[model samples]
Target: MKTEKFQTILVSASILGLAIMFGCAAFQDAIVPCYISPDALDYADANATTFLPWTTLFDARRIDRFMDFRHLWIQAEDNLQYNFLKGLNAFHIRGSEELKTILFSPTGPIGLAFPALAGGALGTYLFSKPKDKRKIAELEKENKK
Candidate 1:
């Protein structure tokens, strides 16, 4: 009986450990940036360099227009990447935080309690009933005869 209980505990622990590991890997992959292109950096630098010459050659209005265009383009690209990473990071962080909250809340251990109750109930139901007692008894009597 003790060995069986120990095996059950080990299996439950292993399953929980696997779940945590999977979650961690998924979160890491999702939040890490993977789509950055080298050309985008080159373009940004070129725009900045081109704006410098315009400030000297063009009148204030024309210079202002060029500068405004450069600034907007740079900002748009940066904002796109920034917001993408921010959203991914936020989703991953929120998932981890939620797991932590469920595991270590002040109220109680909500994570383990539900699983424990479910397992206990299932085990109880499975083990409570005797297995074909009348058949076993009849077979024993026939064998004795």
Candidate 2:
């Protein structure tokens, strides 16, 4: 909780700093000799590198945190490897966070597919009929006697 508050403060401060810089740049000629080339308030460049990198950094940090181990359990819940033969639902999940982050994230669309693919491959090997001759012979004896 404390960490979340700190992160919020840090993000707010960064955005505040960016707004101040943009406002200053818009009419910087009054304070400085040279005028801005395209003008900061021109909205023509709302995504200007000057103010955008700050937002981008914050966005990336948010995604990176979401993609970390804590949220990994959410993605693992539907995984065949995690559930094994337990059916569709996971037996237990040990993670906590906002659903918006996990559900609305940039990678959310396909995030589930990768784990499902991997787990399906693992389940295929684990649950498939035996390829080994020794195991095949052992199975063949069961119906005979």
- Candidate that would win on lDDT: 1
lDDT per residue as tens, model 2, 1-145 = 9999999999999999999999977645333322233333232323323333333333333334444644466568757565685543332331233454676565774577777788999998788564676688888899688
Candidate 2 lDDT at 33 equals: 29
Reference-based TM-score, model 2: 0.22
lDDT of all predictions, in order shown? 0.66, 0.56
Worst 10 residues of 1 by lDDT: 48-57
For model 2, where is the 10-residue window of minimal lDDT? Answer: 40-49
lDDT of 1 by residue, 5-51 (tens): 99999999999999999987765533443332335434434332223
Work out candidate 1's RMSD over C-alphas. Answer: 38.9
What is the lDDT, from 0 to 100, of the residue 126 in candidate 2?
80
Candidate 2 lDDT for residue 24: 79
Model 2: colliding residue pairs: none
